[model samples]
Target chain A: MDLSGLFAQVLNGLQYGLLLFLISSGLTLIFGVMGVINLAHGSMFMIGAYLAYVIASLTGALWLALPLAVLGGLAMGAALEAGLFRRFYKREHLDQVLLTFALILLFEEARSAMLGNDFHAVPVPAILDFSVPVTAEFAYSAYRLAVLVVCLFVALLMFLGIERTRIGSAVRAAAEKPEMVDLLGLDARRIHLLVFAVGTALAMLAGALAAPLQSVYPNMGESFLIICFVVVVVGGVGSIAGAFWAALLIGLVDTLGKAYLPEIAGLVVYLLMAGVLLWRPSGLFAPGR
Target chain B: MTPPILEARGLQAGYGEGLVLRGVDIAVRPGEAIGLMGRNGMGKTTLIRTLLGQLPARAGQVLADGRDITREATFRRAQRGIAVVPEGRGVFASLSVMENLLLAARPDADGRTPWPLERVLTTFPRLAQRARNRGDQLSGGEQQMLAIGRALMTNPRLLILDEATEGLAPLLRDEIWRTIRTIREAGLACIVVDKTVGAVLSVVDRAEILVKGSLVWSGRPDALRADPELMHRHLGV
Candidate 1:
């Protein structure tokens, strides 16, 4: 591979990893704090993509769809948590899995009923559609670079939101000991609701951003969901930092493997997960809380 | 003479089939200090859990400031000016000392933030030194202090301490006792549970003995100290 090719591949890997981070971070958080196994999370991503498509088609602007998707995701997440997830907090993992899996069906059915099964492409915003010149001989895709910038910015915000802020500490503390959170006059249910809502919004946001890259379809989220699971497992069940590093590693491995060795590209991400699990069972950053 | 800050009446609860708290009744008045003392495997922890609404009351009612809160959630009870430093300290192992305190900082029903960040940090100099260290990294004494500080941060009218000085050096234990005295002197209602009978007696105004999931005896601490036979029979002190 040439220098520009390598650079482009690296950029693509980072972009892919960051997107994975956005989705899996929510998965890990919900699992870590609420001990929920949200299989339907991918459905939320799909819904976001569809939301992007509909809004973009109507407004002819991708930017306008972003905020609406986020707000909708938050409302949907909070509703799901209040109406469904909190009830399953103490239930068995199998029940949670079944519940969320059922939600995926319900969500997909609603999507099919509302919009019909079809693939739709979102237009890249006109402002960001033009590529910046990196060198005399080559220029990268402007939309992809914009994705990198947006994902990185979101990741930074997540880090600050969960690490530096008081609410972040509450979330972390609740993950360790929810009863303590209750005893501290902070409702654990509210914390769980907050986490769920944020997770949903981030998933939707990731989907809306990627709508331009990978045309929206009926079950695009299934693939992303599986990859997110791999990221969560490789990172650790409930560690945000773990999800981040794991996402980047998997992204690079999967992307580069596809580019260099397409024959076994599908097996590489799973192989990495297995290797990591064999080394550290719980995950890379599960602080024994 | 004022109404009790917390009152539990006929609270019966247990794990599965084994009943641990059997019709346990206790009350803490404003500015009162209580010592709930019992040997291991008794209902000392159970009663605290039930009172805090962590466990459901199978039989009767739990009232906070004269309002029924038996069906309320634990955090709701906490929001009503009740706080507990539960057994094992109940500190968030993932959070730092400062974070632990900050997470619990809430105004009481009167909307008075009595125990602000600065006040709590000043109350526990050891916690102040280790503000940025995670809960698991702290020693037992520090954990206890952090728990107390965290509870105080809620500006609770009533605070409950379970196993206040279980595993600590003599100096640390004395410090804890001193802090309890200060809390009592500040006119906050408190429930202190400890194995150290002398230390608990020194800080608490009233001593209640738990025997087989019930309040076996309740009297002034000075009276209990004078009666070693009663102490041996109930608290095994």
Candidate 2:
């Protein structure tokens, strides 16, 4: 491929990877810290996209829709956590997986009932609709660049929050030594609820941000769901930094493979995961088991 | 006699159908130090877990500061001035040493000041050198000190330490025992579990020996020291 084309593909990979990181970081936190395998997390992304679509259509502004979609995600996450997820804390992983998988169908059906099965789209905010030229024949969309910047900022915030703050310390402690955290006077249950809500909100935020780039459909989350699991597994189960690196790698490989090796493009990400797993069964940066 | 700060009345608990603490009764008054002694699997740890609400009491009551706290959550119990260093140190491996210490620092319900960061640093100068390090990075002795320091930060009325000096070198164990003496002198109520009878006996005012999930002896430390055969039978030491 040409230099400009390669550069554009690289940018695309970074953008894709960052978006995957947005969703996977939350997934890993929920899994690693709380030990809940929530297969329905992708549905939150779908719901966020749908919420963005509805809000943008109603208000005719991306700015308003974004915040509303975030609130929508937060509310959904909190409600689900208190009502359903809280009950499963002591249950086995098999039960958690089965319950969360069932939630996927429940959310999909609920969305269909409310919005029908028709595809929907969100218009790119006019400010980011334009593009800057990379070369004589190539220009990268400014909206994609904006997505990259925003997702990067979010990832940085999450990293700082987990690494530098007292709340983050408690969350980390709850993951490793929950009883100790309790003995230290912090309610592990409250921390857990917050993690679940924040995790769900993050998945939604990624979906809302991707709404303009991808069509919003009832089952649109299914494909992204599998890819996200790959990102989390490759990044290390609960490591935030690991997810960031793994997402970028997967995004670049998937994007470049599709552009340069069309026939085997679909096989590239799985091959990468397989290679990494062979080298490190616990993923690249997983904490000692 | 002073009203006990912590009292377990016929506490019964276990794991999945196998009873571990069979009607164990114990009490700790304010500013008292107790050395809980037993051989392996005699329910020394189980009693502690039950007191902290980590294990559900199959039957009986745990009264904290004259209030029945049997139904309170573990964190609530901590809020009420109860803390445990725990058997495994239970450090947050993902967090920094400073963060672990800070996270546990909170005033008790009566608004008494918790252990200041400076105090912990002074008490454990080695911890001061490794404040920025993660919990997992610390050596076993440092981790033990951190555990005790973390519990102290809570300004607890009752401090529980299980296996406080397990798997440490003799020097490290000596340091831990000396620290326990200092804490006792500081007038905090403490329940300590250790295999070394002599070391624990030095700090605690009284001793309780458990055998086959039952308290076989509860008396002054010197009283137990006077009867070596009692220690031999219950503690196998």
Task: Say which candidate scores most in DockQ.
Answer: 2
Instruction: List model 1 lDDT by residue over A189-269, tens digit each.
Output: 778999999999999999998999888998889999999999999888777888889899888989999988899999999
Q: List the residue pairs that clash in candidate 2.
A: none
Q: Quality of candidate 1's docking, in CAPRI categories?
A: medium
Maximum-lDDT candidate:
1
What is each predicted model's overall lDDT from 0 to 1?
0.88, 0.87
Model 2 stretches astray by more than 4 angstroms: A135-137, A287-289
- Given candidate 2, what's the lDDT at residue B6? 85
Candidate 2 docking classification? medium
Interface C-alpha RMSD after superposing true interface residues, each candidate, one decimal: 1.4, 1.4
TM-score of each: 0.94, 0.96
